[model samples]
Target: MQIIIINGPNLNLLGKREPEVYGHQTFEDYFEQLKTTCSDVELHYFQSNHEGALIDKLHEVGFSYDGIVVNLAGYTHTSVALADAIAAIPAPVVEVHISNIHAREAFRHHTYTGAKCKGIISGLGLKGYEFAVKYLQEL
Candidate 1:
């Protein structure tokens, strides 16, 4: 099966940005481990700090990939455009959040993209990606 992981904004700073919330390991290291652990699956990753770029990527892979695991970060609350992109896609999308947004600021509690996703995995850290991939695999 084929799957894509798409992360938005500030997430590229994974290891260094906020160790307490996101953990000390960079996504690159974790991604390598994931690739090795799920060797039978073809996994691809893309991260962008730009909203339009993320939407473009979603549109690009939305139809062809078997599944998509997306972490839209702040866009989750603010971007109707991103949500629209998700709604337009054919591939099932699983929204992930390393930290529990509901427990954070009040504004973070709402997600514009969640309603469009097939599922959501929140506060599970990087493991959320693994769960999302497995869920898609099962489907």
Candidate 2:
């Protein structure tokens, strides 16, 4: 099966941004580990600092992928457009977060995209991505 991993704003700076919370792994490290763990599946990864680019990528890959694992990052709490795109996709979406938003800022507690996702994973650092990949493999 083919799965797409989508990351949004600030994720490209993962290892450097806030190593204390998001962990010390770079995006390449995370992707390589995910590839190793989900060897049976084809993983397509994408990240963008721009919201429109992310939305466009979602629309472009939506029908072709079997599933999508998204860490919408800051968009999760703010982007209704991203949520709508996720809702429009034919593939199952697993929303992930490095930190537990609910336990962080009050503003981070709400997600406009979670309701559109098939499942949500958070507070597990980079492991959250691995879990989402495994969840998609199971399906």
Candidate 3:
């Protein structure tokens, strides 16, 4: 199976941004472990701090990939265009959040993108990507 992980904004700073909530492990490290654990699957990862870049990537891979695991970070709550991009795609998308948005500030509690996803995984740290990949593998 083929799957792509699309992370947005500040996520490139996973290891250093906020160790308290996002954990100390870099996403690159975790992605390596994930690739090792799911060795049979072809996994690809893309991260962008720009909303339009993310949308373009979704448009690029959304048609041919088996599935997509996306964590739009702050854009999840604010970007209607990103949500529209997800909704416009053919691949199933699973939204992930390293920290529990519901447990954070009130503004973080709502999601414009998650509503367009196949399902969502939250408060599970980087492992949420694994779960999402596995879920898509089953489909």
Candidate 4:
């Protein structure tokens, strides 16, 4: 199986940004863990603060990849175009949120992209990425 994890916006600051809410581990470190544990699958990752770049990536892998795990971060609540990109894609997407959106601000509680995903994994930290891949593998 093959899977790609897509992240958006300030995610590049994972380890430094909000250590309390997002944990001290950088996503790069967590990604290495994912690659180590999920060696059986061909896994890839892409992150961009730019919305257009993220959309382009979705389009690039939308048809060819087995599955996609996405954490649109702030874009999850906004970006109708991003949601549309997911909806338009053939690949199954599992939306992930390191911090539980429901437990946070009211604005974070809803996701336009989540509505288009096959399922959603929230509040599980980086473990959610693994779970999303596992779910996609089952499908």
lDDT of 3 by residue, 1-139 (tens): 8899999999999899989999999999999999999998999999999999999999999999999999999999999999999999999999999999999999999999999999999999888899999999998
> Model 4 lDDT vs. the true structure?
0.95
Off by over 4 Å in 1: none
Per-prediction backbone clash count: 0, 0, 0, 0
Worst 10 residues of 1 by lDDT: 32-41
TM values, all candidates: 0.98, 0.97, 0.98, 0.98
Q: How many collisions between residues are there in candidate 4?
A: 0
Judge candidate 1 at residue 83 and give its lDDT.
97
Candidate 2, 31-92: lDDT as tens digits: 99779888999998999999999999999989989999999999999999999999998989
The digit string of per-residue lDDT tens for model 4 on 1-139 reads 8899999999999999989999999999999998988888999999999999999999999999999999999999999999999999999999999988999999999899999999999999888999998899889
Candidate 3 Cα errors over 4 Å, as ranges: none
Off by over 4 Å in 4: none
Per-candidate Cα lDDT values, in order, are 0.94, 0.92, 0.95, 0.95
The lowest-lDDT stretch of 10 consecutive residues in candidate 3 is 124-133
For model 1, residues 66-104, the per-residue Cα lDDT tens digits are 999999999999999999999999999999999988889
lDDT (Cα) of model 1: 0.94
Name the lDDT value of residue 101 in candidate 2.
89
